[model samples]
Target chain A: MKIIYTSFIGFVFLIVCSSIIISDLKGPESLILGSWDEVSWEYERVNSTENSNLPLDNLVKKEICSNMFIHEAETWVFKKNNRLQLVKRGHEEEELIYNLRGRGNILEMIHKDNGTEIYQIQDLTKNKLVLHFNFDLQVKGIVKMTFSKVD
Target chain B: MLRKFNNYRTHQDNLKIAILTACSAGMVNVLSVILFFAFTSNVTGHYAILAQEVAKGNWYQAAIVFIWISLFLIGNFTSNMLIIHSKPGKSTYLAHATPLILEIICLLTVSIYLQRFYLNTLWETEFLVALMLFAMGLQNGLTASITNFSIKTTHLTGLTTDLGLLFSMFTKKKYRKDKKLRRKAQILLSVVTAYMFGGISAGILHIKVGYAAFYIVCVLLGIILFYDYSVLKIKRRKRSLFTRKNILFSKKTL
Candidate 1:
């Protein structure tokens, strides 16, 4: 009985491990390679502004930013070879090269003028992608961009 | 080891399970984060993310987080269902072992997929995350059920809450002196320490060996499963041998 039990366990472990080993190898595919369209944008203040003392002032600023910049329709093309293109309505297309760092969650976009912007990938999927980055606009805040797969 | 299952389990047995399972949970959870950038063993963070996504009106992201939480729920349901519906006869060991075996299979499958066909796609990451959540659900459910909800290893929220409550209660001299409370405190501390150690070790090991960290978890679970079986088999052999000797002695006397 002892031998049988031990052998059974050994057999199962061997089978499971070997099955993994014998499985076909798949080539590494980048998760970010695709055409994406901007679906939504969210902005939140992380730190209070030193100058804006009134609560209503911050709210007005947020409202203005939301109305002015939140719903612009834009498309982004991310190629497999680390090329990125931003397309906006009635605007010149901006071309950039991107490098994915740290488990491919941190995206660093290199601009033509020797500038770089880093965005944290909050979420990524076949049909959806969410990117977040922090910046200062009289107050330190985060901007989140949500994208839907266009192609 | 097998006797603990048939009889009332002692504090030591509970502590052993608590420490070992907590270590396994920590290692698996941290390793998943390192590899997939996703949390698999616990649903608390997923719930928070779901709420945040919903608040932001990101319906697609919300749905994905919702699905991850559901997978965890399903895993727990599956584990408890197996435990509750298992026939109450000689096959009890099989019932108890079933969940662990299932967990092993899940971990093994994830490890195999990562080793063989990891494409770093969204679908692949979601699938692996779901698989891990289910595995953890099985482990959490089994440990909780066997120990009467006193040993939860997968998530630290409840454990930390309990620790806080225990610390508050220990302020009273009577509660501090209570042997049961003391034992519970010791068990909780040991589990927490083991979990932290496991997480730290997994962090270092994952950096050194990558996905092989998962294989180590598999081996740890395999030991638990086979150790129980081996002990049972030894006890059964001893009983049979003793029974045969008694029969021979009776025949000679007659």
Candidate 2:
């Protein structure tokens, strides 16, 4: 009887505490809204065999960066209705569906007819968003992308 | 390998299952992470995601995660049910083998489906992840139930906690001298090593052969199934030979 009573109390306590904390928290769906400018892209962890100090800006002109969908985009717009627009300076705009998984740490971008891509959300704040994803190419490494929210 | 249950099992038996199943669990977990961008062996992260989805009002995603969690649960339930309800004597081994057979079927289906019909869609990935989770649940359930909860291969959270506790207890000489405690530490260490080996091997295999690596896990589980039957066969043969020799000696003496 004592054990059952304590268990019940513990369960109720957990429920109340969780509800309180959840009410104050904001979901990533709301946090990721509006336009964000691409701040930079760099190798988070380059393959040991690859040149560690290679400049990504020069590499951006190479096939490695060209193959990535986001490489050409200057601005990312996350709109309502689960749509994400990749806007480039001169190229045509591309739209994709967006979803969050893994406690909102996994950013899933589903491209139309191109399948889905996932990025680990390294950091997310009101002003900035940092994403980490595997960059598979001639010289493969983990890529870290930073985006500053546009006012 | 699968016949013994609970108190009837020895440390060697538990160790064998732990190493084999932990390796497969590690492989399945890593494969799911690399291929589907999700986890299969452990549902801890998935539970958090489900909660987040619900809070965000993403009903569709929440439903999908719910299904994945439910399938894992069902897999465990099915395994335990088969074990506890198994008939006495002759059919015990078959009942234990049934869960692994079902697990093999699940993994084989995933492998074949991915190789042939996979369209690289989000829905397909989610479904594959769910199937993998179910298979892992079956494995974990069978190993745990049969070994009296001494072996759980799918995740390390609880194992780590127990190891920590045991380590603290081992600070005292009494616990160190205890045979059961020492054997447990050894089993835990071996399990950790085997799980790491499995994960590393799966990562390398995924790089080399892609999704075809799942077949290796099935092959390993098949060995576990075949081991006990072979041992039984050899033991029976030895018994028969011994009896024949005894009868020949008696006839000569007469």
State the DockQ of every prediction: 0.05, 0.07
Model 1 CAPRI quality: incorrect
Supply every candidate's count of residue pairs whose N, Cα or C atoms clash at under 3 angstroms.
Answer: 0, 0
Q: Which ten residues in a row have the lowest lDDT in candidate 2 chain B?
A: B56-65
lDDT tens digits by residue: candidate 1, A1-151: 9999997687566445434532332211355777888876655443556533222344654675575322233888888766888888846378787665432445667788867666677677778888766232122226667799986
Predicted structure with the largest lDDT when compared to the true one? 2
Q: Indicate which candidate wins on DockQ.
A: 2
lDDT of 1 by residue, B14-76 (tens): 887788888889999888876666678889878887788779654545555666677677677
Pull out the clashing pairs in model 1: none
Error of 1 at B216 (Å): 0.4
Each prediction's TM-score versus the true structure: 0.71, 0.70
| TM-score, prediction 1 | 0.71
TM-score of chain B of 1: 0.95
Per-residue lDDT of model 2, residues A67-149, tens digit only = 65554688989887678889888454889988765435567788998676767776677899988774431222367778999
